[model samples]
Target: MATLGFIGSGNIGTNIARLAVAAGIDVVLSNSRGPETLAATVAELGERARAATPEEAARAGDWVVVSIPLAAYEQLPVAALAGKVVLDTINYYPYRDGRVEALDTGKSTTSELVQEHLAGAKLVKAFNNISDFHIPSLARPAGAADRTALPIAGDDPRASADAADLISRLGFDTVDAGPLTESWRFEPDTDPYAMPYSAEPDAMRAFWAAAGEAIRSGTAPQTPPHVDQGVPLTAARLRTLLADTPRKLTADRLVA
Candidate 1:
């Protein structure tokens, strides 16, 4: 069993950590606030989890999840995560993250910027599209008739596989949404980016198609996926909404 390190142990980080532990993975948790702040979470996760510094967590994991706010990407410990599988669960909201002209102008997606910072880390974009509140409760057994699917995008095949494997253990299916450059498809405005997984797959595809168009047209307004806390999505409802839209391969060059 590989060790999973989390760089931001907030709502999403802690939820995923709990799920990972339940799935039999060891987790090392960190945050901008330091190890002491995660005492309760560490206590809850028991022997399977340990709290550590961000750099320490980065160095300790076979797989690392970076769940910090997009604005703080520059703060990630690039050198410590080299050659590691890094799951990027970041989404940009101008109001919360302030303004980054490059991202706003479609010059670069947030993951790309993180990749640039941690050039040696194998980066995968996932978990960002789902709500923190629902992550822990939604995982089901692999191939369970009712398992929901989550979208993942990354530049590295092996790293993506590793991420998908981790996702599977958490009780959901994985959709390879292409390379990190196409991660914009799951950005703030896109249908799949934040929509409740409870929706049927067709509705999900339709929502993403509609949302993707909104992004291409420069009209996304930081709207999140519709969610009502505590309500779990049905498996059939999640599958019915899956679609087969053409995968996008965006220009590799980040906007200057």
Candidate 2:
């Protein structure tokens, strides 16, 4: 089995590790907090998973996943990740990541910044648009009636294809969203960001309506109800959503 390394073992990272383990892959998980902090997660993942430092994880796997916060991109070990195929699952949230002048100005995409940071790595933008909690919920076997497809972007076509193949093994299908510069097609707030995989827009709207009514009536729960199930997204459907989206971020909404 192939080994997968993770540089961040938060919700999405651990979930991806789960899927990879299920698909017969070994996983090395790490986080900013250190490997010892991940003991519980490693135990839950069984024998195929182990915890290591970020650099060790990067160097140990044939392929590595970089799922850290966008602001921390510069902290990635460039030399360790050199010449490696890296799957980037980062998205920018100005409020949370502070602000990047380029992203604010539409001058660069998140993956572009990451690729620039990991100059020698083969970077592919992926898994950024889906909700962390919805990953395993939406994955389906290849060619299944409800297989979900994700969009990936990278400058190198071969790297993108390899990423697509690896992601396929993990359960979901993939659609190339062009190069890293074009990756914003699936980034935060875009048409394809979260809805297509969560549920159809109509379904989401209905859920919101009911939630609003419950809130207004003072009958809402402490937490909002999750959409009952996800709607599968086909590659063609994902392509159309990506095509229909026009860049929404314009001038940099600068922050202090």
Candidate 3:
């Protein structure tokens, strides 16, 4: 089994670890606080799980998952994560991450910023749109009629495909939402962000289709629109991390 390391084991990170362990994957979990502080989480995950420092967790896994807030991206050890397949499950929340002038000005995407930091890792964007309350509830059999679909975006074809396969094995379908640049389509303010994973896939697709149609027809409700493009996660000493990249393919090949 591949070792899964999580750099920040909070709600989404812990839940991903739980799901991975239930599926028989070994997990190395860590948080910003320290391994000693993650005792309860490691204990809850049993023998398949262990606690380690952030860098140790990054170094331990075949695939590393970065689930910390965007503000703490610099704290992630980029050198240790070199050559690993990284799953970025973070989304930008201006209120929580503080304001990134670029994001505020519709200039960049959060995933791009993280990618710039982990220059040696094959980064894929996923798990960002769904809320913590819905993650566990979304799991279903691979081909179950009501299975959920999770979108994954990234630059590397193999990495994205591998992520899709792992996601399917973990009980959901994968929708390739395009490159890291297109990840904004699935960001926090978009319909796909929080509306679909907890519901049926078909329903979710229908929702996006409708939203697109509405946007084209000028029937969409006036709400805060999703920032139109991807942004680098950070610009200076204080910033660096976050979500997905896209794989170019026929429109039909977009979803798994």
Candidate 4:
């Protein structure tokens, strides 16, 4: 079984690790605080999971998940992650990450910045769009009638495909949203961000398209009301709501 290494074992990372463990995949978890701090999490994950330093986790994982804040991207072990398939689940929050001029100006997306730093690693953008609370609840078995779909963007086809496969193993299908540059479409404020989709593939695609239309037409809700509620969204219903709603980007909004 391939080991899934985590560079930051926070909420999303920990949840992913849980899913990986349940799927029979071994996991090596790490965080900035240190391996010692992850004792509880490691114990909870049982024999299949162990704690390690960031560099050790990076070097050990066949597929590494970099789930740290955008502000901490530079601190990642670049040399240790060389040639690894990396899944990036970072989102830029101005208040949390401080104001990044490039991100504020739309010059670069968070994942793009992460990709630049991890040049040797094949980076795929995913797990950022969904709420951490919904991850575990939303996952469903493959081909199940209600399996949710998540979007992924990456420059490398092989790497993206590998990410999609891993996501499937975690109980969600993947919708290819093109390369990293186009990843902004699914970023914090775009149509697909945090919007729950149906288990049916076509329904999921329609939800994405409708969300895109709402965003393009300046009609999507500025902040998703259903985020905390975990609304069960369908393509047709989401389309109507998105069209009727209106979005307003604040001055502090993270661009690109």
Best by TM-score: 2
For model 2, residues 1-256, the per-residue Cα lDDT tens digits are 6999999998899989999999999999999999999999999999999999999999998789999989898999999999999999998866557667889888999999999989999999989888776788988788888889999999999999989999998999998989998998998768898777765566654654565456555685244355446778889999999999988783332211
Model 3 over residues 116-196: C-alpha lDDT tens digits? 888998889988877664666767766676566677789998999988887776766777776887777677645465543
Lowest lDDT block of 10, candidate 3 = 231-240
**Cα lDDT of model 4 by residue, 1-256, tens digit:** 7899999999899999999999989999999999999999999999999999999999999899989988899999999998989999998766557777777777877788899999898999988877676688778787787666777889999999999999899877777777887676666666666654323434444554565456556686243323342444433543443344333232244332
Candidate 4 structure, TM-score to reference: 0.80
Reference-based lDDT, residue 158, model 1:
90
Order the candidates by TM-score, highest first: 2, 4, 1, 3
Reference-based TM-score, model 3: 0.76
C-alpha root-mean-square deviation, each candidate: 6.9, 4.9, 11.8, 8.1
Clashes (N, CA, C under 3 Å) per candidate: 13, 1, 13, 1
My TM-score estimates for the predictions, one after another, are 0.80, 0.89, 0.76, 0.80
Worst 10 residues of 2 by lDDT: 247-256
Candidate with more favorable, higher TM-score: 1 or 3: 1
lDDT, candidate 4, at 61: 96
Global lDDT of each model?
0.77, 0.86, 0.72, 0.79
Displacement of the residue 126 alpha carbon in candidate 4, Å: 0.6
How far in Å is the alpha carbon of 229 misplaced in model 4? 7.4
